[model samples]
Target: MTSAILVSILMTLVAASTPILLAALGELVVEKSGVLNLGVEGMMLCGAVAGFAVAFSTGSTGLGLVAAAIAGIATAMVFAVLTLSLTANQVATGLALTIFGVGASSLIGAGFVGKTITRLGPVFPESLSGHPWLRAVFGHDIVVYLSLALVFGVGFFLRRTRAGLILRAVGENDASAHAIGYPVIAIRYGAIAFGGALAGLGGAYFSLALTPMWADRLTAGRGWIALALVVFAAWKPGRLLLGAYLFGAVMTLELQAKAAGVTWLAPELLATAPYLATIAVLTMMSLGRKTGRLDAPACLGKPFSAS
Candidate 1:
């Protein structure tokens, strides 16, 4: 019985972590291009509202997901225009973008408050659902499996692909990349938009699948945690998977502790576990003296302009 319970708990952790994994993976690519986007929270909020609205209106989860991606990409285009094309400060522009996303999402979601929509059902084969081991591993929604696939996909692309090499080169030194005839601005814009679309998809997962309910501020800073995970993982996709699962496990454990009537743990402290873990991982990364080597993009947060 104890073993069964433990397995169930682990399964729950995997499910809870999928959204964070998806969003973090997108942000990982964005930062890899030497662009620091702080507007993930905003983009996610927009996706949440947009996805919920579309799902409610059309009664189609597929269309809702597509709309969410479009909304996120549209919002990201604003950031791309300001930071990448106009050479505005990445940090300030990202923050402003996030602020806009938050307000816009809230106002748009006002009518959606307290609304519930039909959720996307689990995507596994019925045969697998009853098999104990397979159920534990494969019975989640399609998004969970896709998130895992993305982790490996991004890792391989960054390490092996020619396009990935060019992206990395651009992030490392845009001036040098530009001198070599690479389209630095175009690369950044595309990467930023891709990141935004992925983040939006993550948000839609919450509204259309996880909770299937609308609420203001529903993301609750998962975006910030995703940002931290990029740094904690040393900008590597494989490590991002580990970091996301670890945070997800911590979050699940907190909820379990609360449910099991663990009196010694304060509710507030339990809620802080994921954030605390992020801070700890970041501190360790910084203290380990890896910034000069396997750390952030060389030009991260720096505005790039063609001379």
Candidate 2:
């Protein structure tokens, strides 16, 4: 491919990767706080719809993103109340949240089917964003740059800060953290809310940045991929960045293949590329786990109560 074509492909890869990275980063923090929320997909859909509706109505992608985050927090609060407050089964509640998200987004977005909006533009001026050599680095929208910054920020938070130690303490041993006077359930609620907000932003990237339109389940199954990506990265933020980009490259390849009309591979198989990679990555991680100490939070998926 020529240089321009290569730049286009790279740009596409970054755009495709940003949402997953954002979602996975949120989920990573949730898991680190000892919560295994399986409703990332559902939360994403809710955000997607809310973001689209607000953006379309007010003509502000910024406000749309805020709405998406609020909607995500609201949806996550539902999970938090059920799983943390009422002590419901985490896995089951998560599944139900996904189902609820699907129905709710569909209902809210029904009027928006086929509606279009202006895509979010890059933060930099056209002089840089449109520059031949600099566009690759600066051409991305605010969310893309934000996602990259978050990777480092999250890594620093988890590794360098006192609060990070406390959060990790909760995950490593909630009882101990509680005994030390830390509020276990409260911290978890915060983590869940944060996760929801990021998931919302990730979803909004679809409607506001990726396609700039509304569609039923526009996120498709990327939430699941993001989940698997957490495990694929062994729960490290830096590794998660690489994993997201790797998956992005795979997805980009699929689109490029279709555009090129390559007949060597079946179209159906090409379409399944991302999912197939998800499965493969998950399986490999599972096998790797058999030979190593588990890297997951010690209290992951376990219900906790002060009583």
lDDT (Cα atoms) of all candidates against the true structure: 0.87, 0.94
Residue-by-residue lDDT tens digits, candidate 2, 1-307: 4888889999999999999999999999999999999999999999999999999999999999999999999999999999999999999999999999999999999999999989999999999999886889988899998899999999999999999989999998999999999999999999999999999999999999999999998999998899999999999999999999999999999999999999999999898999999999888888877655459889999999999
Model 1 misplaced regions, further than 4 Å: 290-294
- Residue 178 shift from truth in candidate 2, angstroms: 0.8
lDDT of 1 by residue, 205-264 (tens): 888887888888888888888898898888999989999999899889888999998888
Those runs of model 2 whose alpha carbons end farther than 4 Å from true positions after fitting are 289-293
Residue 133 lDDT (model 1): 62
At residue 193, candidate 1 shows an lDDT of: 92
TM-scores, all candidates, are: 0.96, 0.98
Clashes of 1: 0
